[model samples]
Target: MNGQPGTTRAAVVTGADSGIGRATAVRLAQEGLDVGITWHQDREGAEATAAEVRDAGRRAAVQRMDLTVLPEAADAVDRLAEELGRVDVLVNNAGVGTAVPFLELELDDVREVIDVDLVGPLVCGQRAAQRMIRQGDGGRIVNVTSVHEHQPRVGAAPYCAAKGGLGLLTQVMALELAEYGITVNAVAPGEIATPMTGQEDVDVLTVRRPGVPLGRPGDAREVAAVIAFLSGPGASYVTGASWSVDGGMLRMGPHAGSHLESDSWRRP
Candidate 1:
């Protein structure tokens, strides 16, 4: 609440080129927050998201950042805050996933996923918290996680491991940052329809999976709405929690040694 009194609230969202990140950026802008959008490789898409933010009558700043580099992640947050004036919210939504068997997975690939999903968020969150504390205002940090954070996936060993670690990390951050008035939380989305997974081929409603009770893939906006709640004033008391948006996917029993059909759902 110690942020600029008359200036609009600002947020920095990484991986905002497309999918959940893009949708969250637009949604935050619509909610009257200026947004700083970052893209890993999709400059055009990031610009498009910025355009939408501008059209919403909010300020937008777009940047290119590779999350694998910790310095770059911290630098991006600093740059966003410098350009946007202030960052009241930071969304760690950038991540990578691969569908390789655990035994067959390369060490390099596993390390890459962990670096992006874990270390990257840590760097960005630390930078954001530093600014928030210095400004004497409270801030929010929302980590975009996956259902795999609690539930394991057969072909997605690295993703599950990274997300599980991220879940714990969120809790630790929430506890440590509490004194600074910064809240840390996570949104673990199940299956959201986004470009990261070939959107055309995914039928969330039609996919007959025994796990997901909703029997449908979630929409990016749905996840974005939850993130908005946490980023906004309503969730001031909510911290150190990873809200699962997986439509009950993690509640299913684990049937090991059972041969299951390839469920080609991808995380965005």
Candidate 2:
């Protein structure tokens, strides 16, 4: 994502049909930018998000995006850029995970996870950056990685690998795209109270996660607020960094050794 100093800010957020993507699209709209939203299996949810953005008095364009078809996924951003007349932000929030154990996980499942979580974002980010580079002003790209991006979790081998790879990819993109004035970053959310976690229509502020330091599940808006910061003027100097919005869940690792009172944490 690259934009000039005076360019109108527009954003394309994948997986916007629900969850963090939806919150991000809405939040960016509230911040005064038009939004383009995409989804693979939920056009209704995407439209709902569009309505929310419109309610915020911003234009919204909805489309289908499936990272399994890499080119089509990338092209979704182009379509949005055309509709919004500019592309200043690209939030790569679409991702999938498999819970099957490493030994039991199918090759196809691993392939799908890698394609959706890692390669998909890489390609989509490149497309957005290319447009931003052409636009002559730098822009922003925020990849919605996961806590797994920094550490592994049981039964999530493929997801951990893909997010871990995406973390490094964010750095590489930041280094290369900096010349064009584009900033690339990642937002690693621990456990957001959204449909992905079987917690739809949730009040994020009240969600609890006893396992984390904050003792709460993060709201999608909390994560989006961080993404908004990265996309807005305040984060102009920030790039190639991964912001953790997981209620400090990532910091619990060291304490687990001596604090284990039960095996509940190991339960999936």
Pick the lDDT winner.
2
Quote the lDDT for 252 in model 2: 81
* Number of residue pairs clashing in candidate 1, backbone atoms closer than 3 angstroms, sequence gap of 3 or more or interchain: 2
Residue-level lDDT of model 2, residues 1-268, one tens digit each, is: 3244665589999999999999999999999899999999999999999999999999999989989987667898899999999889999999999878888989988999999999999999988999888888789999999989998888999999999999999999999999988999999998888988888888766754556766667889999999999999899899999999987788888554212444466455
Candidate 1 lDDT over 24-114, as tens digits, reads: 9999999999999999888999999999999999999988889877676679889999999988999999999999988899999999999
List of clashing residue pairs for candidate 1: 204-216, 204-217
What lDDT is reached at residue 7 by model 1?
77
Cα-lDDT of candidate 1? 0.86
Q: Estimate each model's TM-score.
A: 0.91, 0.93
Give me the runs in candidate 2 sitting further than 4 Å from their true place: 1-7, 256-268
How high a TM-score does candidate 2 get? Answer: 0.93
Cα deviation in Å at residue 115, candidate 1? 0.8
Q: How accurate is candidate 2 locally (lDDT)?
A: 0.89
* Per-residue error (Å), model 1, residue 35: 0.2
| Best by the TM-score measure | 2
Looking at model 2, residue 39 earns an lDDT score of 94
